[model samples]
Target: MNILHFFFGVCGNATALFLFLAPTVTFKRILKNKSTQQFSGIPYVMTLLNCLLSCWYGLPFVSPNNILVATINGTGAAIETVYVLMFLMFAPRREKVKIGGLFVFVLAVFSAVVLISLLALHGHPRKLFCGFAATIFSIIMYGSPLSIMRMVIKTKSVEYMPFLLSLFVFLCGTSWFIYGLIGRDPFVAVPNGFGCGLGALQLILYFIYYDKNKKTTDDNAIEMGPEKNPHQAQDQAQAQVKRSDKGSQNGRV
Candidate 1:
């Protein structure tokens, strides 16, 4: 292999490893808070869908040359499916429904399109269709991180956005981009380019909000405990509830 191929392969391998490790933070949160509220399965669901689609796309390339790609993406699909299943078992009813819907949608629409096109097309046409479809799907998958980034900026809290996860995404995006370039696959490289940019933005937002909230939380600790003054806390909460109700009424009016 040439230097370019070696570099891209190493980078892609590293990025995939990072993707594999991204879930550690979620497990840590589950252990730390003893609650699953901090965990969201949407990202994992989307990732699993992406992996499965890639695996399906790589099926036509059974030239002994693309087996590595198929194996990695197939493993990713299985692992992601396991993660989603675990989340479904543990998550709230509402979240479980959402994940289920996403799973069905991906399985139905995406699988059908790829299957139909693969069977319908022939020879070089098959390669072209699969490559094109994979490229589009990859771009959409890479864009999934934007929602988390938006949530972080809106809340000004990285509570739902783990720094390590974002860092891995950044690394993953970079590695895949290089992999695509080396493999001469425009479908992979183009999307990962945008993915790398978004990943960096998420990491920067993490640092900005992490320290900003730390001081506020520490400052609040010195004040009266909502736990110690239950009545006061209840009244305060009720007042906020009333205020919210009034705001909603006014909006309706």
Candidate 2:
């Protein structure tokens, strides 16, 4: 069991590393375009907070036998920082200010957690407090794709959701979940269990919609961006109906 625990931890580390670094592709695009486009930087900022909390929770004093948790999350924190900085660099003025303020808030929150954990908590109490903080943020990070999932169902398409990203979500979540259970740490287990479930749902969605439509991924798909126009869907549907009507008229003539 001990060996198995370590094995999963290693697996978890690898997958989580991929998850942390997965945004590299997006960042590269941002750099090439010399713009952040409409991409939101909130996820990266929140993820950095999650990583910091997890790192603190995984400490030897806070939680024993979980050095792997700290190892991976610590690396994640560094990576997310870079991503956040990049967002600030290329984002438009409005976006730059938004991300800037959020970054400051993350630092403040993390500082509070650190202070309380060190001064007010000890032993199991410290673990529970730190673990809870980590768990909440981790779950937020996992569920960040909720908007994308909604878009998939509404459009009946999986084109916007990348297959590799969904696969890694499942892999990373399952590995950490198993590692946590074997080590008897619910902090790691619960949030990851949620993530694993979400990942499975996404993959199921991808398969269900895969190849079902020969049209482009954006065909009939609702706008999934943060600033979608509410009337866009109705306009798209009306346009589709008009096209059908025109086609029928031409066929008859």
Best by lDDT: 2
Model 1 C-alpha lDDT per residue in residues 1-253, reported as the tens digit of each score: 4577557656666666557545654555555665456346666777776777666666745222344456667887887787777777777788789888988887886677677766787666766666676667767767765655555565555544556556777887787777677777676678778878877887788778885525323221111001113334335445655897899999999
Candidate 2 wrongly placed segments (more than 4 Å): 212-253
For residue 187, give model 2's deviation from the true position in Å: 0.3
Q: Which residue pairs in candidate 2 have backbone atoms (N, alpha carbon, C) closer than 3 angstroms, thus clashing? A: none
- Residue range 1-253, candidate 2, lDDT tens digits: 9999999999999998888877777777779999886667888899999999999899899999999999999999999999899889999999899899999999999999999999998888999999999999999989888877776677665656667778889999999999999999999999999999999998999888777445434422222122222245435545665897899999999
lDDT for each of the candidates?
0.63, 0.83
Angstrom error of the Cα, residue 146, model 2: value is: 0.8
**Candidate 1 — what's its lDDT?**
0.63
The CA lDDT at 72 in model 1 is 68
